[model samples]
Target: MSLQPIDSTQRIQSLDVIRGFSLLGIFIVNMIAFHSPMYYYDPYSWWGDSINRPVYWWIDVFVQASFYPIFAMMFGAGLAIQYMRAEEKKAHFTSFASRRLAILLGIGLIHAFLIWSGDILITYAVAGFILIWMLKLSGKMLLILGFIIYFLPQSLLSGIMFFASMVDPTTVTYFSSVQDIESSVANYGSGSFADIFGQRVDDWTYANSPAGFISIIIAILPLMMIGAGVAKTKLFEKASDKKLLLSLSALIFLGLGIAIKTSPYWGEKNLAFVFTQDYVGGPLVAMGYMTLLLLIMTAPLSAKLLQPLAKTGRMALTNYLLQSIIGTIIFYNYGFGLYGEVTLMTGTLIALGIFVMQVIFSELWLSKFKQGPAERLWRKLSYSKK
Candidate 1:
């Protein structure tokens, strides 16, 4: 007997729905970087106008750091699912996983360099390789390990920054330089493709600095572990029997997430508060969202309503890359040259427009095909006997 991929009947509708939902948030956040000098400017002051500030605040509290954690967790869940399938079939999990991640790395490199500087796929793929090694641990242990690894470094850094801010508030707000910002505006807005490529490298380098590995590990790996842990406990299989538990967990998580996320606003947008808000509160909100979506999915009516989103989620990778492609065309010099020109509100609206178009497109495309083109290619390469 040989291993085979899971069919549509075995797929989780709720998971798909959640994944589809996160794509919107991720695009919304990415749009800010796509059309602006996001890397060089301190966001708080850059979007400080009365009009943009409220838009920025809405993004900060509800959208910014909130969605990616959910996606990272889901990525781990996906790995765990494949691992369990491999084990069930007595196949070689490690080799298959390695090849799979390698392909993802290749795709990520192209996206990060040739397409967009703000790509998360490269980081995710690299961290996934690390996660594949630690899959042998028990689920509860994985969860505990994830919590400790994430909390310790994040809290310590937040504390250190808070202390430094006490000495001088500017210490935490000095990531910008006039030349970098001006250069970004120029290159992305009106330069040739070669010029834009040069700027893309600079932007990617700044975001993925070599020294930030530990930070990236804590940021990405922990959520992934927690997700794998959840999968091990068979939460998806057994969640149906625990609707009440899910309900309570959703409320508590959402409440705490919201309260903590408001730290920058109610407490003050100091480095400490900002760190706490993004690093600590963001994941909490992501958890809340996952649970809440799961709970809603339990309802027959709600599940039916969210079926379209599930389709979107099923084609996640295709849509993600498409977002970058479309975003660049709309804003980059090669397209409309609207880069570094749109307001926050306008950029956000564009993101929404893109998502809406994707939803319609996914629905139409999946009506006949089993998956997105990118997913088909990934599966073909991974499962091909060649």
Candidate 2:
């Protein structure tokens, strides 16, 4: 079906507010991924001796499981909203949405290759492409599929770890070896600026190559679909209406985040060394953040503060790229050349500092500018003159 442009002025503030908060969430999580290893664990033991550092430990505990889920939920919300706009205009859906997704994919590829290796935009674009089809599914069905796709991988991985702990202590030991950890850290530390950039280019090329980034992105389709379903139903419309759901999600997220973080069962001997070394705590905190932010948006008193976040959310792509450019210069060898030297706690401070600046800047920028620079271009590119 042909899809139409959504009303520019008729946006729901809750979305922009949630999105603004989500941009911060993305930054918090991406900061860790930006500074540390590609995977959850640190290849180099830069932070190993300091893992017991209180600030570092706390950050890891709260942020690990948080951001991506929030982003996932937001993605779903957007899909629902977009589909609604299309329906409202009585336009066909597939072509326009596909064009948008394709642009996103292109942007993501550039982000992955030219800027950050840990870019989620590509993953989101890929997921969005598939999620559009589920717009016709009943909300309940969409919700069910969302949880199933989202949880299956975690459940399976956890099960494997549980069984391994019981049956193969030696194998787990090998996986957790100090020797392996040390070697990994050393490799990362030794890489030249050129080498790191080369690795990023390679990753982007592979992800966008004929092998297709879409399939890999499929892994997150369920989460995005659920998010879209949530959007369609106006789940965030009135947080008061869904107080129970919000509270429960907050509790579940907090409980799981704490459990996974503090569990000695997963313990110090495991990948906590890896996960804690980066700013792993941002995502955990981001969930708590979203819950609180959504609740706050429902309050009349906080509308002023909510406005900036909504503005930032409106220009999330521009802000996201800004974060990477700023972060890379501050941390990488090509710029400040302080990649391995900065502590996790300090890196997080830097992220928060930059974030506050962006919030203030975004608020001011949007006051005069109609859209983010990139957002304006995107709108121009995505639409034809009617």
Candidate 3:
């Protein structure tokens, strides 16, 4: 097996740190689903009390759609790195990449069905297949196409929603079936393991139905392209070379992201506005967060402070799966049976607590080994058994 480099003092990449940071935000947002049937309920309408309402509002504006983009970009960049390594080694890119993604798909399948339904690994693995073909595109071309492909559909959809809201907002579907929430609570909160599995299938289907998936593709694929482009261009270094410019750009993106993301609250709070918030605003915020983090990490003291995240990020896939495992065990009937019982605040606390443990776990794990357990398994499976 490949080992961690012989030199132990090499600086970790900022990308890994960002990946680790994204996990906390992802878990925080996912905590909503872990504790409640958030998919079936209208977030705008739920969280009735004083405590939950503000909690939801904070998450929606800052954390909800924001961090996933960072994660997606990281995934894309990491794949680009792998592609580069393959090219350097004169390896057959196609067969190798396919096998790797296939392994990911298998892992995702187990995670989605056996553990939890809110799985992005499956989607990423599938997207990796598409990205493999697109890797030949130049960084500039990738960026151009990524922006166009992503924004064109997203803009059109947002426009349609906005116009529809203006016409009659009630027709827009924010929440799914009333029965969905009830069944989810019954199965996940109190029923047997089999019951939770059944509900997992339903939840996965509800989110990934053909029509719904088109939206996911446009959102995910373009970001992947942009991320790959960034990696290919080495843009992070160039952009970061000038702290003043990077800071200004980061502020602008953050300001704009906040403004656009809050449209649902400030202007309409309707389905159309919600779409804009998730699709458009989320990426902007992600860019801002990334730049800002890059800047912070470039500084000596702050970088040292945040180094634990790099350790966690190096083991990101493992931590992500572990999160699902922990979350399921905490919420599912076969485990703690706390589903539908924990509040938003409580779930946030749980996420924070878990992530802290993961940071420590990652540090400890990496000290003695090269990769996290899952990542080691993935690498081993992707290559020769010998």
Clash pairs (backbone) in predicted model 3: none
Query: What stretches of model 1 exceed 4 Å from their correct place?
Result: none
Candidate 1: tens digits of C-alpha lDDT, residues 1-386: 33566789999787788889999999999999889988787788889998899999999999989999988988988898888888888888988888888999888999999999888888888889999998888888988998898878888888898888888888776466889999998999999999999999998888777877557766999999988888877777677777998999999988998999998888766667888899988998999998888888888899999999999999999999999999999988999999878899999999999899999999999999999999998888777462
User: Number of backbone collisions per candidate, in order?
Assistant: 0, 24, 0
lDDT values of the candidates? Answer: 0.88, 0.66, 0.85
lDDT tens digits, residue span 65-109, model 2? 466667777877877787787777787677777888788888877
RMSD to the true structure for each prediction, in A, is: 1.4, 4.4, 2.3
For candidate 1, report its TM-score: 0.97
1-386 per-residue lDDT for model 3 (tens digits) = 22222123533368888999999999999888888998888887778688888888889999989999999988888787677667776767788778889999999999989998999998898888999999989888988998898878888988988888778868775765689889999999999888898999999998999977766866898899988988888766565476887699799989999999888888866678888998899888998998898888778788788888998998999999999999988999999999999788899999999999999999999989988999889988887643
List ranges where model 2 is wrong by over 4 Å. 1-4, 38-46, 50-52, 173-194, 202-219, 264-289
Clashing pairs in 1: none
Candidate 2 residue 62 Cα shift, in angstroms, is 1.3
As a whole number from 0 to 100, the lDDT of residue 198 in candidate 2 is 74
Question: What is the Å distance of residue 376 in model 1 from its true position?
Answer: 0.8
Worst 10 residues of 1 by lDDT: 209-218
Q: Candidate 2, residue 285: CA error in Å?
A: 7.7
